[model samples]
Target: VNLRSFEQAQLVGSPFIATNEKNMGGLPDRTDDPTEEIIDDLVSGRLPGVLILDPIKAGVVAAETAIKVHPIRKGKSGVPDEQGCIDMAYNCNGCGNCQRNCPNDLDLVEGVRLAKEGDFSVLSDLFDYCLGCARCEVDCMKEVSPLTLLMHAGRERIRNETFNVRVGRGPIQDTEIRNVGAPIVLGEIPGIVAIIGCASYGKEIQELYKMAEEFLIRNYIVVVSGCAAMDIGLVKDDEGKTLYDRYPGDFDRGGLVNVGSCVANPHITGAACKVANIFARRPLRGNFEEIADYILNRVGAVGVAWGAMSQKAASIAAGANGLGIPAVVGPHAAEYRRMFIGRSDDDDTWKVFNARDGTPDQLVGPAPEHLLTTAESIEQAICLVAKLAIRPADNSKGRMIKLSHWIDLERKYKGIDLPNDLEKYIRVEADIPINMKEEVHEYLKQKNWQPRDIVDPTLLKRLCRT
Candidate 1:
């Protein structure tokens, strides 16, 4: 089930799929939009059914959508985005502070005012500019939410708009698992990057294409889902090839896999779990602890949600983090005000237990520096993805190659040829790229880089036989 559109993604497998912004109704806590009828089946874990009078939208949303709300004019500057969201008793005072808070410089006030007057052109046009950070609502003194106005106008304009889209491809195929599994274990594949999130980065969606290409060219598997998948497809090269047309839709090295919609997000992590079952011959049931440990130490995967704006994006990122896979969220994600940050400077933070035996290892280096961190730029995010892909169980050759790409990306994007702290991950001469051996040797000497012991690392404390 490729999630065709958020505006009309009704499902039957409980309300789990409703976590996406597009599937924005049927939640127990959500009561403001009382107009929709809740399907008892979806709530009771039966067949997935649609929630009528959806808070997200009323009809199907399509690509290449063009809307005109009629009678365009300059709207008032002081109005809150939603007409009833603000309390008039507090007095707005016409400060226009919310406009300044927006990262994309969208005039939420004007868009709301125009929408109230039935002129949706400004609102419709501004939709591309709004990343749904809800900063306007946050910074406002009277608790005004601009996202509501955008959603309202969008629903009103797109009611009858239903475009033919290929249905969702429900799961990551077993063949894909079989094809990519061994190389991943052997380190031929440095990492699997799941690029997700909404169109919240606004007009800068091309950054996704460039970032995906950088990894794809290096033989990294790139996976995408939901609106971010659609947005990335919007960009094309001079040859008129989107990333989709350029790469095979395989879960292999250098392949591009689109799983369709946030509903398929489980498949992203499920693929990781499948690797343990299908590739390593691990027990699938009653083996979560061992499987999670394997993923953390050996899977060499990271998630990049560069334009995460909604609560659903945050929830998804947190879920991935909980499973021992690291996630890098966009700057707007910082507003969530919660992230598990690791101190790479402190040696103690990187230590892990060798669960396969009874021995303990000291300072394995920052394979995953942070479980969930924010990247301010596309370059930083790209480099972060490379850095996070370093796993405790990576072989010497794999580590060397992964480090080479990370260094290259940093040099290309941030203009620094070598990371300031590079010695922690250098296990041996082979771990350093042959070209940079001398330079790295001198650098490691200065930093007093003591080669740390890494043999059969699994973070599960219970597995230690001591």
Candidate 2:
């Protein structure tokens, strides 16, 4: 019941694991017990940060947690040495620890008090002001994160009064899937890149937009959701056009699909499943392994969570990997203490089960090379996405298109030096770009490159030739 540990899972699971019993049966039916109450509040929002909320909400430690220099609330005109109150003389009961710990400095305790009295309209402002930083949890004796009080309040208000919530738009439509199916299958487009998660503070907003536009110009299908969906639209050109304003919101080359809040993430990944269903007539019901296999072998999809400060975004990135989609997170992602980076140098690390004979085959290639990895900068992120988008199922033309972007981004960002080990992926002369064909040939000749036969890939032998 420390309640602090729940912070990590808050981002992705809170939606399905909600508070009010009626509102999805309340993940645990959040009772008034201090621990459940704190979890109640925690479930209301999803933001990860360094300053964990004050868990010692019921202890004296709260008094010394913050700067201890703010006006007391109306409940207590606190005197110096007053029990459970700061030294400042004021009418508040709390030590103002929640206020100071809040990144936006909102009155979290007051919100809770208001909810108890059934006047939760005060919490409306918290939605915008609260950046989801769970900093308020420092050392609560009762072990509760004051950060989640907002959620508990929201749930209480809703349990008393009913309101209509809008249904989120989910999944890629059949037509849009059909449209991008050919481009993705044929490799006419590099890959479908989904940029999701919150915007990191102080990071240049335009940097994300530029990365997306880079893929857009290269004709990579870009899908954005959650706060990242909005960040890419904050910057504009001389024409006052943001990426959203300039590009069509479709699932095709040069299209920018903003699929709404984090709840709509299924649409982005759903598009991948839809590809197998719509294009190849693969059944969509309860077929995860085969569908995942199809995506790994053929679908050139990559997820770039450049600012996934929350565990929900981390979960989304993990979910992407579950589907064989390579995920790239920002440099700060290393703090999560988990990653799935492949060793490009170790040949054994690149083995794939060639279902053709239920036998393992060594791929002298980097097909979705690393499942998950950190990117230090935007340039590296761009190059990495393109690099991971490569798969064995890519026809000559498909690999051709993907490699062009990978090589171009490497040269553009890292400077005129071509990407290292470019020979590992090029199976035949046709896989090289038309303009750079000779240069690639020269490079391949020096490395003694030989053409490789494209194999039918399947991790499960059930689908292989008997």
Candidate 3:
């Protein structure tokens, strides 16, 4: 049978026979005997099953669609429910593609081969080498994303193999943050800011951490998870130890807590609830509601989920906003509009704010021009929230202020530096290698600008003038 017919039959779960005849002619010429070579190949075990016309075509089929008919060996007690070989093949092929496409040039293919051979020890190193960017998926013919799949799978295995995986109903162990000197002191603080999202390659996340540190300095409890959390070392450094080691006593009052993996982001919401619960006690309840009212009304506790496609972080932010918490997202303006409005066009719950000046007034207000990095976004969000919290008047007014407004007001209101230490960590074009630095400098110089500076020249003007 032809390859297409064979594929169709396989799809329909049908059994069909092939004959050594051209167009089903009873009398066959030697040249017309198409099945003879295939039959001989199959009988000699040179072919695994039926021989297709071409090896590349056959390999593509096998790689893309081969199913595990049966196990090569039985388990010690019984047959394992999971098909190990099939899993190995699928994962190995994906890993090969990942290695080929990796910009860092890591041996993802060999890593997966070793993993398939049952080497768990190398898994961590293999995964760590991944930039956690999904470039491999773009290059793959099968549309498999290696970084995400491997990270998730590796995390599951590590979680299962290391600690008896337990799901705590409430907050993760407070000691987790305590060890880092960034403990969650619930009622001790007025509010908490959660920085949630995926970590992609580039300096965006590093910038976010600097921002988080600034919030910590301001005594706002900060929670982070997922790749955003990982980017900030929440997974490995449970206690904010690394952070404290770098900036001792920096996080003494406010804390930086790493909840867990991406799945643990909702824990940030729970922590917020805990904060609400703490303030809801008798005398504090009125104050709490008042504070909640202020936060709900003026102060913003925003979540930034740029680079990640999953709208989970953004959704959580909206939920918090519904409960009187404010949120800021870094997704495209349209998506932000969708999340904000939901089904109702009349709902202007989230006062549109942006760091950029020319941002449409209907969707986003201006964000900080310098707060381009994910870390910066987080810090900026926290700073904005902190500013509103500090000002009772601003909170009561129900005004949505740009992050830059608070950044400008930082020194005046709180006597704190507006840019703070976060600016040091923000990677800019000037921070690139010396050779590359010249290129960036030249580019900006030609445009009469500096590195990291926004040049908003109109395309028509530039084109027409040139």
Candidate 4:
């Protein structure tokens, strides 16, 4: 089941039906609070296996379970002091520092001030988007915790009322990508770029559309979920139509696929799994190890959570990395305390199973040095994402496409030369683009680049827990 705005829910369509009848009739103009009605459905077991996308609703369910909450470790910048929002609300000078520094652009100073006057609704949406990054705490001169204030407001708000939404088609089927011949016959289209995560970063939605547009124009498949899809939905073209309204939904080059809400996230990863099972003809039904190894070695896919902010988000990242698909998180993810970083210089770190004998062996470092790493900005992420999409299994065409973009981005943003070992991905002279052939050849010559061939290049892990 889904719970978001009516329009947001309808975009999901089939296989997922809205639980609330009011969704079809449009929201009712009732005096009754919506949250109360939802609680009734959940408690009475009317809605089974409901997926909570809205953080507020998730919090409400947690509260009802009487779970002790620790949003962040104690004594972080944004916890309540001896006196909390009730006492410190008056101290907000309205300098707007909190709002300015907020990645999501929430009007936190105003929300806190209003809460003090007995109104908590002002910040309701903001709390829904908050990642608890505590960037606001660093900006607040008053030492007021916007995180604390938002939580108090959320607790109070949850007790009162909530909004209604719809449940649309759940997630994309892996069979779909198979029909399109993905991973095999992948063409010049390099890989799958899944841009996902929270909207709390306050990034202008247009930036996301442009990002998708860039990759789409370049023939890469772009997929979105949750607020990232919503961000794209918010942008309009010269015709004043959103990408969701304008673009065709397909898992192919220049096609934008919106895989519904956050719960549908697995479908993004599922695409990679399909590449192994369907296209590569690997076993998948229950053999998790073989499938993950195939994906890690063969499929060229990467996930970017540019605004990950919650524990659930962390789990999603962990799960993806565990599957051997590396992910890139936004800088704020540093607060999450865990990022899988691989050092290319440390050959010992590049351990993979040579499926030839199902024995662990040291392989050359993969294109992306890390399974998961944080990017300081979207520009860095765009570059990192392109680089991450390179796989050892890439043909000369795929390698050329990936390397060109990675080289251009590195020059454009970081203004650095390509690392000597980067030539390891260049299997042959034809793999290098004509424009950069000499430069790449020169680099390769210095590194004594040797052509290493894998008779059967499937990666395996010593241990894989389904």
Model 4 RMSD in Å is 11.8
Model 3 agreement with the true structure over 326-403: per-residue lDDT tens digits:
455553323444433222222232123222243322221121111122222444444455433321112211112222
| True-structure lDDT of candidate 1 | 0.71
The lDDT of each candidate is 0.71, 0.69, 0.42, 0.66
Rank order by TM-score, top first?
A: 1, 2, 4, 3
Better of 2 and 4 by lDDT: 2
How close to the true structure is residue 268 of candidate 1, measured as C-alpha lDDT? 90
Question: What shift in Å separates residue 181 of candidate 1 from its native position after superposition?
Answer: 1.9
For model 4 the local lDDT of residue 56 reads 67
Best by lDDT: 1
In model 4, state the lDDT of residue 125.
59
Please provide, for model 4 over 351-380, each residue's C-alpha lDDT reduced to its tens digit, 9 standing for 90 to 100: 555545665563645655678998887778
Candidate with top TM-score is 1
| Cα RMSD to the true fold for all candidates | 9.6, 12.7, 18.9, 11.8
How displaced is residue 334 in candidate 4, in Å? 0.8
The C-alpha TM-scores of every prediction are: 0.71, 0.67, 0.38, 0.65
- lDDT, candidate 1, 311-334, per-residue tens: 788888889887778999988788
Of the two candidates 3 and 4, the one with more favorable lDDT, higher being better, is 4
Please give the lDDT score at residue 347 for candidate 2: 68
Candidate 3 C-alpha error for residue 462, in Å: 59
